[model samples]
Target: MGQGQQEQVATSLAGAVSEEISASLAPVDAELERRYPGDPGTRQPVHTVYVPGDAFAVDTIRSWGEKALTALDTHAPDAASFAAVLGLSDELAEPVHARVRAKLEHEPIEDLRVDFEDGYGPRPDVEEDETAARAARLIAEAYQNGTAAPYMGIRMKCMEAAVRDRGIRTLDVFLTGLMVAGGLPEGLVLTLPKVTYAEQVTAFARLLEAFEKTHGLDSGRLGFEIQIETSQSILATDGTATVARMIQAAEGRATGLHYGTFDYSACLGVSAAYQASDHPAADHAKAIMQVAAAGTGVRVSDGSTNVLPIGPTAKVHDAWRLHYGLTRRALARAYYQGWDMHPGHLPTRYAAVFAFYREGFEQAADRLARYANRAGGDVMDEPATAKALSGYLLRGLDCGALDIGEVARLTGLTRADLEGYAAPRRGDLTASTK
Candidate 1:
């Protein structure tokens, strides 16, 4: 329940570092390699990626879109002029085929959401189901004809009326008409936007469950991911584990979890002011989530950086990428994957992903040398070995070297064997032997 062993840990770490300093001959990296032995590593990656985003989210139509994507890759702020925000048509419907077709053909776009096509809103707005039906017809026409082609995904309206009274439930008939008119799904995420607790997750699960049964839908545990963007969800210690338990409650029907950085920061009174992706407060929130869901099966990811850097110089562009990388790496260290709210941010998405996995593995490899005593048998105490091994194993999972089920499959001794038998030294031909 206590995700952190900090008071216990900080003291032990201080002691260990002191001891290591006193014993100057040992290479912190090498000394541990030899003292503890681990078995051969057959570790495969558990995370598919550490960064992801929407291909054609609203930001793309703006003049700064391209630069924004680059900024996401790095962390640089845009120094150039950005296009003014345009609402309505950008948020609402279009003028049928020629318009949609030209938008796809000439412009750089990848996907579109069928927003409010099927009407299911207030007594006045209950026609959202009809809107969904209309959108379905439009989408099917495009797919059948081949002019406007994109993998469509729609964000559903919130289920609660108190929330609905304030805002609109955008997509009412997506799932209802999904199999009927729109064909099958590429992927479905019931993007529960402002959930603050596990019970909200359970509520969503119940709805999905009952819906599937009533509709005779075959997928038993319909997977849906949660968005932890509320102050309540991120701040409460119970909030984090509650997410894992929610997924379990659904009997393994969870896709992924996303950090709603801006909304969460807003909920905490941090800001709707800064870019959502790279804020320091957001970083702390992400860290807490990571520790909370240490062994859960769900894949968690950091949210997107909101400020679109609209500049020209390559230097400025790369700087944006740098920030994106730092934020991404930090999150990856916490063991989260995926991001949202933009598509032009691909290069950043791809780059951060590699950096996280690579750096995490490299750091662990360096630490393993210390933990296992350089693959030799010289300088490790049992207690130090245990702590070191625990950090290594946990970090490996954080770095995505293992998953929850895999963690349970092996004993600590097995881990010790896989890590290294003793402190491994340079040119040690017998190193990695259990």
Candidate 2:
């Protein structure tokens, strides 16, 4: 067609959509906005370290860091030795090892939970109350003194009939203590364990609502991780996915859905000897949790391994290899977080995390840089791919895996630029040309 004809055709096509169609679909657009809000674009801790409530103390964080360092000193005293144990590549060994050591010295534990559930077991009401209050005091002091982890809170007992009342009382004591101390810290986190039904999640949300009302805080001020530790939590008796319902039931108060490796595996009748996070049963449950949490601002975390890296050097090496392999495997599967049950697990955790990001750092940065500049490359990139690339680097930066200077140098984009690309509004992601 002639240029004049083409110009006329383009003008005619500009307003082809009817007002009736847009008006009819308005509610659907609102529903879509409400339902899938995408990621919150905040820092997600790579692991949550659990300590029994009664066992928690002011020195717990430092103690864990010290113990992890001690383990490194005893088992693998040098980078080469540690790399040999984990079979890290020559290119990654020195940098990954140095970063792991620095991370251990500075921020060994990212997220910590003072466990009142299985780890604490059942305690006398009076003793539990005192312990709960003590935990609050210590945690508050830690934050005040600038010695706290990035995230810290309690894992209260589940809402099961046998322990529901105790759990409520403990949470009340803890939060009330925090309020009395100096108001809640921004780093506070909570975990609700062994949830099986959506109604239980609703009940938990209601409990939080009541607390907020009592404290004069804004509604939805509290959010907790829902622990998926039962088979029923994955698949209801009626065959619908109960985890999805649980997320919705949280009423915008769900921060994460954390898999419970042992509890979940045992619920499926997996033998104790065979129970592990990488087990088929555990994978299935976590996969469902991941899908349910996608685009809901709720993160998914994998469960922990019971194996402790202690005793003889040979035994500890074996345990380190196991932990390192599992951590790498989880990262590969996009399960960026997990649970750490011991101080010894810290070394391997950082090592695996650092290696994962560093190995792919150049490729991710190059692709994102290309997309940012809109430069043509061998690969055809889209906005979604760019978002993923930016997210990967952002996560790496958040967890000490990548430095901001290096990221900026490679991508030629600042942190604010990365955040804009990583967390664009729903429709903005796809509205731009490749």
Best-performing candidate as measured by lDDT = 2
Clashing pairs in 2: none
Candidate 2, residues 1-434: lDDT per residue as tens digits? 66656453334433436677788899998877777888988899999999999899989999999999999999999999999999998999899889988998999999999999999999889999999999999999999999999999999999999999999999999999999999899999999999999999999999999999999999988999999999999999999999999999999999999999998998999999999998988888888988888888899999899999999999999999999999999999999999999999999999999999999999999999988898868887778888888999999999999999999999999999999989987787677564
Residue-level lDDT of model 1, residues 65-103, one tens digit each, is: 354344433342211121001111221122211222232
lDDT of each: 0.46, 0.93
lDDT of 2: 0.93
At residue 270, give the lDDT of candidate 2: 100
